[model samples]
Target: MILAQILHSLFFIFVSYVLYLKYNNGVVKPSYIYSIVFCGLLLFVFNYFFKGLSNRLFLFLLMFSLSFVILQFMKKFVNVFGNNEELAKRKQLKVNVLSVQDFVFKKLFIGLICFYQLLLIWVPGIFEKMMENQ
Candidate 1:
């Protein structure tokens, strides 16, 4: 289980890094990509640590701490990115320039990455099923 959680966390981190690269290359808007990556990392860490807590009270405390970290990250991100009108306009222009297919593909790719991470963390049985089905 620990190995599975580690692999899942690594997978999420890799996917988020890919998104970060895409944003840097102007393939996607930084605001959305950064937000998504931040959230993904938070979820990854939450799942990783949640499995280690044996006591319910400890688990709840860990979850609360994770929530606080997530909230603080978002607040800081918004402070840096949200109040900048120029950046917002530029990102909007970039988004507008994306083709429908490109937009759909990006969304689908992120969805798949997130789903795979969740499956690895919460439903290893599903992975076994997929392998059997194959």
Candidate 2:
């Protein structure tokens, strides 16, 4: 179970890095959906060794495939609200400036994933507690 938790943390950390690279100010190649397929399969295979109808694995799966959704929703949020012009202007014609937003977003989202892996967030001990209550 501890190993599972470690694996979960590492996987999401990698994903957070990937997201940062995807959004960082640069010429990104048009992406392929294969990246998503690859990540999901990788996550499933590592966690498959544990046998359970419901457990932290189920929660992590929701985090990866559902709750997170790669945070693509941020595009709409950024569009409707607006870009961080203060951050944008700070770049000042230099190329390859590090995006503080992407960096923070990486930490924020990935930090939650790691935190939830450790604490289980809203679903903390949910199944185990239910089993005990019976």
Candidate 3:
């Protein structure tokens, strides 16, 4: 189960990284990848440390909210060390932007990443318990 969870988290991180790279015109910045992995590890640790909540619904809600909070902090941390060249490039590229499309795609990717992280942490036990109850 631990190995499965790790693999699942890695898969989401890879997919999210790929999506980010694609949208960023193939700019493979190490910071983005690191931040994504760091966020995933953080999520995994959080899930592991707090797995004893009796209320499954509350656990779900907590993980969902925690993902957003953690992601937001990660974004802020990355932005604090933003590269000057990247900032310049972004300014230049603003004229050729697809804001709405990119915005929607980015949000969808983030949502998937969060959802998968939660699933990785909870799905096995949650489903097993549900099946036993039935």
Candidate 4:
């Protein structure tokens, strides 16, 4: 289970990095990278810290914390990219928008990876008991 968790974390980190690179291309500023990485690490820590907590209240808190970190990252991403209208316009002209097929495929790929990790976390004894016949 520990190994599975480690692998899942690594997979998520890798996918997130890839997503960042795809969105930013080669023009991402260094400060933005630092901010994004910091936010990502915070999310990771929050996730692992709350993994064993089963109380609804604590779970809600953790979820909120995680969401906050992700929002911070998104804010930085938008501030760095979206605010640069000239750069964004130039990039848009040079690069094709991701095709619907490509977008859907990437979404499915990431979703499956996340779902598989969730299954690994819940299998055998963890969440299985919740579904057992009474």
Looking at model 2, the pairs that clash are none
Cα lDDT, model 4, residue 66? 48
What ordering of candidates by TM-score runs from best to worst? 2, 1, 3, 4
- CA lDDT of 89 in candidate 4? 68
Clashing pairs in 3: none
What TM value does model 3 have?
A: 0.33
Report the Cα lDDT for candidate 1. Answer: 0.50
Candidate 4 pairs with clashing backbones: none
Could you tell me every candidate's TM-score relative to the true structure?
Answer: 0.35, 0.45, 0.33, 0.27
Per-residue lDDT for 1-134 in model 1, tens only?
Answer: 57545644554555545554553354555666576557555654665576631233223323433443364356555654445567577986545544443444344545554555555456556645655796
Better of 3 and 4 by TM-score: 3
lDDT, model 4: 0.47
- Each candidate: RMSD to true structure? 14.6, 6.8, 13.8, 14.2
Candidate 3 backbone overlaps, count: 0
> Clashing residue pairs in candidate 1, if any?
none
Better TM-score candidate (2, 3): 2
In order, candidate lDDTs are 0.50, 0.51, 0.54, 0.47
Model 2, range 7-87, lDDT digits (tens) per residue? 555555555455555555434344434655565566576556553223455454456634454475654565521355664
The most accurate candidate by TM-score is 2
Top lDDT prediction, candidate number: 3
Of the candidates numbered 1 and 3, which has the greater lDDT value? Answer: 3
Model 2 alpha-carbon miss at residue 8, Å:
1.5
